[model samples]
Target chain A: MSDEKITPLIMPKWGLSMKEGKLSDWLIEEGTNIAVGDEIMEVETDKIANVVEAADPGLLRRRVATAGETYPVRALLGVLASEDISDADVDAFIEAFEMPVIEDDDDAEAAPLYEFAETSVGRLRYAVRGNEGPVVLLIHGFGGDLDNWLFNIDALATSAKVYALDLPGHGQSTKQLAGADLSGLATAVLAFMDTVGVESAHLVGHSVGGGVAATMAFDAPDRVLSLSLISSAGLGREINSQYIDGFVNSVSRRELKPVLINLFADSKLVSRSLIDDLLKYKRIDGVQGALESLSAALFADGEQKTILTEKISSLDVKTLVVWGAVDEIIPASHAQSLENADVQVIQGAGHMVQMEQASQVNDLIKEHIAG
Target chain B: MARTLSFKDAVNEAIDQEMTRDPTVIMMGEDIVGGTGSPGEADAWGGVLGVTKGLYAKHGDRLMDTPLSESAYIGAAIGAATCGLRPIAELMFLDFLGVCFDQMYNQAAKFRYMFGGKAETPVTIRAMVGGGFRAAAQHSQMLTPIITHVPGLKVVCPSNAYDAKGLLIQSIRDNDPVIFCEHKNLYAHEVDVPEESYAIPFGEANIAREGTDATIVAYGLMVHRATEAAENLAKDGIDCEVIDLRTLSPIDMDTVYESVESTGRLICVDEANPRCSIASDVTASVTQEIFSSLKAAPQLVTAPHTPVPFSPVLEDLYIPSAEQVADAVRKTMAT
Candidate 1:
């Protein structure tokens, strides 16, 4: 009868604006033995569609939420318990479970979803979570904002102070760029850390953000505790220039949707809202020029301009290189470039590996930083 | 950087930003700077509804108050546009197009074509259109069909605040004369609009809501009606895709065709009177281009062939309602 024995699977909040999601399908059947990180159900949000990975391992007792019906954030979708728990006890538990009441006033005061930081790079928009422990900065890739870590930030914040920021010319940050190359972006990140009063911390970067993180570690090794690069740039010379160019040129939703499909292994994950959000960002006055300049400076002629494998391998900083096995943007083979770092090539994911396999990525990062 | 802005504020901000960016941009209209020569505040009524309320203070001499003559002022604006000046002439009500018809259709619209590409009229005429404020038949009329019928002029009617701002900026920067129709009822309606100036390209139809059961095409304030109808239809297990044709002339028929191809049903909603209205134009185009794609005959939900009523109750019923649009959708579903 201990409450700790029952693990309730609640609907997850994927992003800042995601209030509810439809339980599209249940991947696992009732009474199945669940393991950590096992795909249990598929949830479809307006922004994207992703599978819900098990956070707690237990025997699946009951499926409470119906498939194809939407449930609010933190609504109990299912229950998992040990074999000792009876059917009546499980039924009673399901009947008694109450949905968490969302208090708008209290939640606003407790945790603001996003914040603004006035760094040397100009006004930068960022999201901060966790109150204690070592700081972890999450830098998104080109044309991406802080929300790229929507699935990973809260999970990592459980153990470490996590901050995800929009790089210049991305997200809600100032569209003006300090510089377009890796060194320029790296300098902006350092300025952000300095402004936020973070002396040294772990740096987690995705795509071009990975290049910026590496550049930071190379330029100022003492400032970086560790580095986690997921499907990152600057590892090899070959990249999907088509995606880079396509992202820079596409203006309309029809034109941009196909370009975004290349970013995921499951193209279905690129929902309508995702394309609409990107279009809204792209339509901002300076965003197009900023993205075009960055594309030319970083990936001109479809080749990576900055290669840091030799330099990163020489550094003594702890590094974890993770890549989606079927990453189309940057080949998963690039994960092998950093011989000194821990490399993990995840299967069934594309360029957006951190989002496609969020729990696994979060686990790897936690263990890497803690080690 | 995106914040909620009323359609009125969005239009004001677009003109303000464009004026700040280019010194040549000027605004001239009756009462745009209300109390121009009076003993009271100079920039008094910044347009009839204050859409241009504070512009006079910022760009003092640039915003001019003209005589009540629409023909004289519109002609002057067109002339100024051809001579390197970008002028946004406000025609208080679109129904007044009858008074300034020759200047708009003959002069500005044909300048580029008649001059064999030598002349370019980068003038924007901003006017309030549609009937929901009980402004009677004259003050409130959707005369978009008249201006859109002209070959050289670009016609834009935005549905929400975001599109209002972007399309207005585009209209100002465009090389051709653009008749920017601002719906009177949508002035108070708010949506997220970026503070920074951005131009939405012409001929791009925004799919406001995505669905599969049927396709509902609308423009201006009727877009809200169509979306409402779609939501109501959803309760009956019907899904409707609503497309907002942001611009009329050089309209985005491709987006409409794409939606109808999948949904196999079409409903065109326009606040204007039925004959030669945007609804009829869209229905005719859909029938001509992709007739086989439609599983059912296209429906046009529009005002009856009469002037907008002056009475409150009659006016409310005269304009196409969400219920009427839902009824049309139901008919399509039945087919």
Candidate 2:
């Protein structure tokens, strides 16, 4: 069998939610010699479009998936093999290929990846991926769940034991706020770390979650290895309060669609399903109250209640601050406020740059962690 | 990483996650575990099409391979659900509902209502439905309306893998019996589904596409077709809003009513036969509720009132196409 020689170029999985991606175009056609990491195809997911780089070096034998057609993750998009392999063999291989069944022995006995940790703050839902590595915790913004890190978590998990948590008042966690203040939310993070038995972790937080992360770094410097804030709050006083107010007030699709558009540079990214998902989250029994309380606590006067810029430099931990240039919620200028932190303002990205430009952000985070 | 999974795999993931979450959650169906008594691999087949494959390894006895008797096993599953075990009974095909529907509607569906709300039958009847499989009349049928007519039962048909996972999770967690109709044709259709278990609430319609010219309501495989039609319609200057009614019993009529009020045109597309189907049901509701708002009468594009033909050509014609839906929208525009 020439199976050992033929390397399948499959549709890459970007996040936990992405099932299939459209092959927009193939950069390296059949019969082209390709090296590892060479750009081969442009794949478009519902969330973003990314180039599929070759993982194996060989001659591009065949492009099985047609351009503009979508294929499932791991479905053979193309085949690369030695020039010695005939077309007939490649055709046979493609015809006989069945999607391999996933069966990892370690995975079978392991606890559910997404587990709830009981803390004094409340029951916090956290997904822990990669069993053995440095601990990394992802904290999402106000109204956002652990899903905000959907793109980054798996990517970061490659090098670290990543944990993305839904804070007390958000997601599937306890809805009732104990204190509802920045400190209260920070304490939840601390309690969650203690509950999960993590002595220290690299904290990557977005929006209000970044505020909570900063507060945690200040409260217990020993517990935080490093901090990476992405378009985070607490760096500036001037915030797009209308965005916050609109997010909190909009209950219907008509009202919510426009509100969500502010989060992205390209309003076209505000998909109907995205709006619907938010509506569903909002409709959860205690979610409305939780969101309202959190919003009030964080942005009481249309400005970030706590500016941690002064204390950020004082913290002993290494810090990285990333902001979207067109961030409507929090200005990219806020990235300049952090005295001791390395900052990058991603061009053409809005508030949700971590999601909007996940690959770039993921690369940044990976680089930061490695450094 | 976000992995693309077929509708079958999504269904499997939902059941697996639920089983892992709750100890009482169990699954039973003929060939679900596969190779029950015959001399073959223990976990072979995994259902008629392998939707429930590999789950047996994780859950073990909780994932059961039942006898060939649908009436007996489905009844047992329903009875078990009433007695604390949340049984997910695979009905194999919706067409087989004839053999065990009494157990479904009469017993499981009615348990909570009839028992004065004391009983909770948290049973999910997972079955493959719809035509285009060339499975002939008996094996292929969108019998969603038959179950949706029942007051106590919750009917759900997801158009994609993401909804399939979430809705199935909701169905299993729900205290009432849920008939989850998996369009056989859509089994291979892939979409992004979260690894973590999340529930999409019942009755919330997903607006697949937003438009101002017309509103197209559909579910299951037809939702995809409606979306295709909406895309085609867009090129011709018709912005058609396509709504996937993810759940039938607790239908989001509010969304439909709102859409029709704005667009002044409604087109319902269902793969199910035209007579008293979901399309007709939506048409009737919209016509009655928003008759004054509508610029033209509501149009319904559905399969003809006949058995699903075996021939590929006949079956292709029998299943309502995107072109037909677009034509219906055009007709609404003309009126």
Candidate 3:
């Protein structure tokens, strides 16, 4: 028996609720040399469709899971081994692979999906992972929740303690807002950190959330170790008012589906369940008013009300601004507004770059936080 | 904020929340506050299925246990509606509507129109409908089409607990009189429902499942059957879209038209009898409006034009089954 290393590309569990994913297409061919963070295949979950990136570099020896077929979480999808590994050994490895059994009882007892914290704004819902190292907080954009960082939370948690929270008026948090402006949201985030006993943390935010993170960093620089903004708002004045208005007014699945497509480069990523979940959230009482108030305060007349580029640039904290090259909601050009910050405009992605290119975004964030 | 709740509990919660929010909201029904004069438990039966079981305790005397006089109480509820009170009268079973048709169709339904828009009848008539508990003909009639046919009345039949709560809230707040049809068989069916009160606007159909091959339209308990059929058909490579027509009156023909236009096939699943039923009505509307979009003649999967049978086996067959819906979808696919 030769000591040859082999890795299995398993179906990734995106969020706490994701049980399985349909392997839609293989992006890379077998026999291709794989690098860490390389896009390997596209997987479709009930919520959204996204490309699965490689976590370990190796030779792509075999593709076991067929395209268009769904596999349970942690079920082996492909084999990644060196050229020295025999075909017989690869076949045996594939045959012996057992899909991870996720016992509902054990899982629920082990890690509760989310926790609630009573903040000054209202009751906030959050998910905390990891126990040691520096703390990192994730803030999601308008109409988003902690689940927006589904792909990144666990990855970042491998290095640092990570916390992702749904802002007031979003997710399972209170729909009543203390205040609906950007500063109001920043205060809520600060209150959440206080309730959770997080003194200082690296802030990773997306879109409106990015603006909130920047505001937190500017107000209390000592509390924010570093800032990683992904397709953030408040750096520019021009905004997709149509998308905002449509999202606010849409009451049916048909009406909301088209509006959500503006957030992703691949429109097909907006699956039926994604729209349904959003519709469910939107239908909650007081949610409509809360969203309307936020939109009015932050994005009045189809333009961003607050521009914090100068303020964020002047801050001494380490900053990283990431944008999707094809971002439609807020122009990717706003990424260049920062004078003394690292900027990365990723190609083939849109406003939701953190989700679309999750592996790259995760790597960048992990490195930035570490630095 | 959302947790699993049965349809029975959801309906109760809707009424309870509405009553708590607005002092003008009141409920009157036969045995709704159960054991009223019996000196036993004050709020005993809580309607036949205990849907309004604990509500009386929360909103005391506001939940009046009316005598078994449908016409009188229904008329009184409609008259109270014109005068500020938003009354909800539980009509027990929809089959009992024959005794109180005039109070609903002529009085409550035509209040605003006949009174030259000066009157507003914000009354909701809650009645249990459909078969499958062996309730037989008199009790398990799907009289939605009868109520929906009227000009001014808004008719709603929710399939699940979430829809039940939201639609019920909307019905209570609606200015026009509403006939809220509760499927007795689906009362125990559970789904995640938010505790807070929210309203789902009428005339907007929910796409229960998305597909590209065919479209199946249904409401009430039939929505579940249609969805099951779509899922089963999916295994056989026959993708079908299922639309839940939550409200019958002010029907969402636009949604039906959009689905049919894409899939180019239509199958309407309704628990009501076939003749002049909602199934036939939707089929006719889709065929007439988007004639060129259809690749095949639309099909209707509904109970045969006969009273609901009492026998266990016959009653099981009397209601439209998932198998029947699948067969209808398969026929459309073949065409």
lDDT of each: 0.92, 0.86, 0.91
Q: Which predicted model would earn the best lDDT?
A: 1
Write the residue-wise lDDT of candidate 3 on B160-258 in tens digits.
999999999999999989999999999899998987778898998888888899999999999999999998988898989999999999899999999
Candidate 2 off by > 4 Å: A1-140, A143-206, A209-371
Query: What is every candidate's C-alpha DockQ against the true complex, given to 2 decimals?
Result: 0.71, 0.08, 0.75
lDDT of 1 by residue, B196-273 (tens): 888898998999999999999999999999999998888788999999999998799999999999999999999888
Candidate 3 ranges beyond 4 A from true positions = A1-4, A27-38, A59-62, A102-108, B36-39
TM-score (all chains, Cα) for each model:
0.96, 0.64, 0.96
RMSD to truth, every model: 1.9, 10.7, 1.9
CAPRI grade, predicted model 2: incorrect
The chain B TM-scores of all candidates, as shown, are: 0.99, 0.98, 0.98
Q: List the residue pairs that clash in candidate 1.
A: none
